[model samples]
Target: MTSTSTAPGAAAGPDAPRPAHRETLRTHHGDTVTDPFEWLRDKEDPQVIAHLEAENAYADARTAHLAGLREELVQEFVGHTQETDLSVPVRRGDWWYITRTTAGDDYPAFTRVAESPELPRGAGGVPAIEPGELLPGEQMLLDAQAAAKDAEFFSLGGLAPSPEHDLLAHAVDLAGDERFTIVVTDLTTGTVIDESVTGTGYGLAFSADQQWIFYARVDDAWRQHQIWRHRIGGDPSADELVLEEPDERFTVWFERSRDGKALVLQSSSTTTAEAWILDLADPTAAPRPAGGRRDGVDYTVEWAGDRLLVVHNDGVEGFALAEAPLDAADSSAWTPLLSAGEGERLLGVESFAGCVALELRAGGLAAVRVIPRRADGSLDVEAAWDVDHGGELDVVELDTNPAWDSPALRYQLTSLLTPATVAQVDVASGERTVLRLTPVPGYDPELYREQRLWATAEDGTAVPISLVARKDVPVDGTAPGYLYGYGSYEVSIDPSFVPTRLSLLDRGLVVAIAHVRGGGEMGRDWYEQGKILAKKNSFFDFVAAAAHLVDQGLVAPDRLSAEGRSAGGLLMGAVANLAPERFRAIIAGVPFVDALTTILDPSLPLTVGEWEEWGNPLESEEVYRYMKEYTPYANVRPVEYPAIFASTSLNDTRVFFVEPAKWVARLRETVTSDQAERPILFRCEMVAGHGGRSGRYRKWEQRADELAWLLDQLGATARV
Candidate 1:
């Protein structure tokens, strides 16, 4: 293992070899190699030979172990995997059920079950029924499965009584390709209400009366998305384009006011976001600016009665919730209802029954804040509930996908030392209840605890790290660890629950989340410091965190595994290139390793939009040089790297599947050591994009594959 200092600015010893200067090589296939480590040609060096031998031995052992467990993992996942074929549309009352083909080559089927009034329940209770189960009052529609190789439910929202009037929406690839076609069906009469008369639709919103539907469609060229409004049971000609964003780099998100009198269109360009409001009463009316734009404001709006609740940065560093009367035409009329202060970073907000409920950071801790609306539109501070302690809080955590109703919010919270717990917090009483605390079946939470530590980056910036391990693991500290991070896009990888993660934890493995720069955990300033020219900070921060853990006796170098996805994948790849001996296994999912080449390609979906995140390579030579410096795919060398698993989907539009495909191919061909073991496995979701598949079953299958791979690497076994 390579020994390094945890403290910033620590000088290397005189005996330490001077690092080599590397150059990148560009191939005719449009791929670029940034750091070709030519100095490693003399592999006879003791240091190089030792590193290569250890890596080869580990790889050989892992290969044999994985071969033995592959069949068992597959069989275990298959049995535990539940079939999800029923569709539950948003209904008027308690229950909303629809039919779907469950198993075998049987005909398309139907079923009925009560929908959970509060949280979204899985299809565990819904029983499979034949066609005879359909009542005369109920109706069914099965579109001719032509070119519908993977026809499945997209989204089941808002249902009407009659067959001709019921609204069922889904994004399907009727062309038998990856491009999606938005389809809205009237299940009552079994007819297609709308089938994306325009181009491919991405985001959808329906008016309160359900008469008007607003959606954003993606097209080629300048205007990537156009927001259009269509009336139900109306002619296609009646549909009108409400907002046309001519800049292909911009994306639009629209939401109707609670009363449906106003529509808010948030136009997001590369780095900036601007919102505009339109009067639905007057379709031809021009949209008025909604609020002032902040440099790193990722604002989301919500409506409560006659007022609009804005979760935005009021030209401040962090986020806060503000409010303005819906009747106010001027954006300046918006008033600061809540201020962004220490521990007041607003994470989420929901409006219910004339009250605004919020999830925020208070006192450097995760907490809930509520404000009740008065008759005149002003708000009164209702209550505040602290979810976790400031010291115990994982600063870089985010909520597990939450499900909420009007009066109660249901969500799961997980921290470094804590298993995920499904909790329900009542708005009125400020009472918090834990519904389900994630358990490893036999393992106990009392045995594991999380420790929060801080390390300094090369620039003396304080980086936070969360380390989770079994309590029995001696503080004298000899433990294997898995470090994870995704320090880009200002995204905070907050603590969340994953059952598969238990496979590592139960085996006395320590899992750590490195809250590196380039993420939103510390604030907008932190993100700005780690992106673009300062992007190298992300790599160094991860390395510093790892060193901190080892210095603190939490783990040894050879026992650590590094993992990341997408931009985080880029982080994993770059760190591996910089210090391969620090980790045992590296996992890069849908990795954007070939950053320089992808940025230069205009044909990619989000390439132009990324100029704000990664800077424009086409226009600036400086950016071109900096991007090449950290581009993972461009930095591959002949040195023996840790056992690597780089995965990508062929249908992924955001990062382009070819980046990983090209990267793995190059790694396999160029690398000299079979000991490094570049297992470039490509799991192409033949049916989906960016996000694997639409159905729950399809997603679990993917998860199973990932878990199997992780288990194989960690030398852990899955629960049978």
Candidate 2:
């Protein structure tokens, strides 16, 4: 593949040509003090007006092309997989059940297994192997006959009660566009008493009585959702919009207090959010603001009789679990039960068997059973369980989306390392039994290892990178390494197991996750350093980490590949443009490469929300000029570019597919690389959104395609 000329001050190859532009781009957004909109506001100068109009026109055309490509890609990828749904929901008799659709089927079958059990013993005093198991050290081949018999799993769904009073379980149904549905099951009769109610959007919270269901639904305009309440067993037509924003710009998130007396919701306007409380009895009552100027708050509500235990942000850093008298109409009645700190956040709360259980994260997962102050006015921790896993429990792998039946204490205890199977902490006996360790199939934990490494960026900031590879791989720096990063939105990329990733490591690949700035790895400060005017830090940190790997002889430039998604896609595109020779191949998946144009457009879902990450171009000329310089699509020049694979989704409302589409198109037009040999493939998923596909098999296929592309670039092959 032909490579681009090195920028001024950039290390150059022996044969590489130097670029004319030697100066690095300035990215200070605050330097331009004057109104950046002055150019648009004053159209008297024909040259300025013409330039603005041309840029606007180009942006509009690109957006339309992207939208069209999204639709086309969705259609193309839809037929590649059979319909299948996967879900775990609590059934009657407190049994946890999993439901899944048969290949090519629309409906799901459910399976029920006791939360506590032991396999039947076998001959000769040796434990017998179950249908799903094989002899020790042997590969467990899935039994076709057993799979057919297990097809009855979905039938368990039919056994749940559709009760008017029972709290419904939320199930994510994949056959229907992967939407979540709420259904109430009768534990006694083993039948569903209520029909499934489709969820509004992503979030869902149930009321105390199980009659009222609170959820957020998307409307026509912006991507924000309005909180709605639906009564189970009541007329579906009677569903009420409990809370909504008249202005389309703001978004609201709502949840019910454990007692169901008050509805707590957060209304966010751009970067700021305000919490509000509404009386459940009086739906027409105006919501009272709970706090002010709080950037964000993590909370959960639990009921202790008539009072509410609210884990709230008290206009301070971190959070505190407090108590409030719900009997009063005033929100001021709330009082803090526990102090807030830099690392304190409430994970879950459970009130069962006349005991109030709370799970908190101070240093590690801490479970404390609280005895509400009797009429005597004294508080005490009835029982406490401090999860001392010695950091062996990988908190990064815990699913952010908690299960419906997730215990207030046990969930917090096992909410790490790929979702613990069962954390059986007996409050009475103080005995704990962890059942069925969650396994990343195909991964031998003994053969793999994880380590934390820090790389110093150009700005002298230490960027933490997580490295995971086969322990068997020689440290002699000969392994093919893949580095990944996403440094936007203060979203921390935690350590999670991906089965496909193991395939790469098994093939002598060293995978590294660069925890760069503009991410919340080290908390808010780390994020702030890499966003807005400091956004260049994100790019620089990634490049620095890649350089560190090369300098350390962990991987050579020609053997290293960088992979990123969404904003990380922007990172991949920028690094590939800024230092194309450093990476062997670039996989930019569902990228936001056309950052400048997308930020300028008001029609995009994340445009307004993104002002915090990428400064408002309309408000500052410095931001506009800086973004224009590094904008992936705009930055593609006539040079020998690295081999690229840009993937896009047709239905992604966030980070629309057009970004990658336009990027690939621009690279094809600008670069002189051979189409066949140094291919820049544009693989668009026609039916999927931000997530490629719904089915496991389909996702595996996409992973295979991606891995195949990377291996092909590295001149490696999947061993048959």
Cα lDDT over the full model 2: 0.57
Q: Write the per-residue lDDT of candidate 2 for residues 401-428, one digit (tens) a residue.
A: 2223223224323321243443434444
Best-performing candidate as measured by TM-score:
1
Per-residue error for 266 in candidate 2, Å, reads 2.9
Please write out the lDDT profile of model 1 over residues 471-575, one tens digit for every residue: 776655566678999999878777654545555675567788898889877766777888888899999999998888888888866567788988998999899
Candidate 2: where is the Cα deviation over 4 Å?
Answer: 1-199, 204-213, 231-238, 246-249, 256-263, 269-271, 277-315, 318-323, 327-386, 396-408, 412-431, 439-442, 672-675, 718-720
Cα lDDT of all candidates, in order? 0.60, 0.57
Alpha-carbon deviation at 699 in model 2, angstroms: 1.1
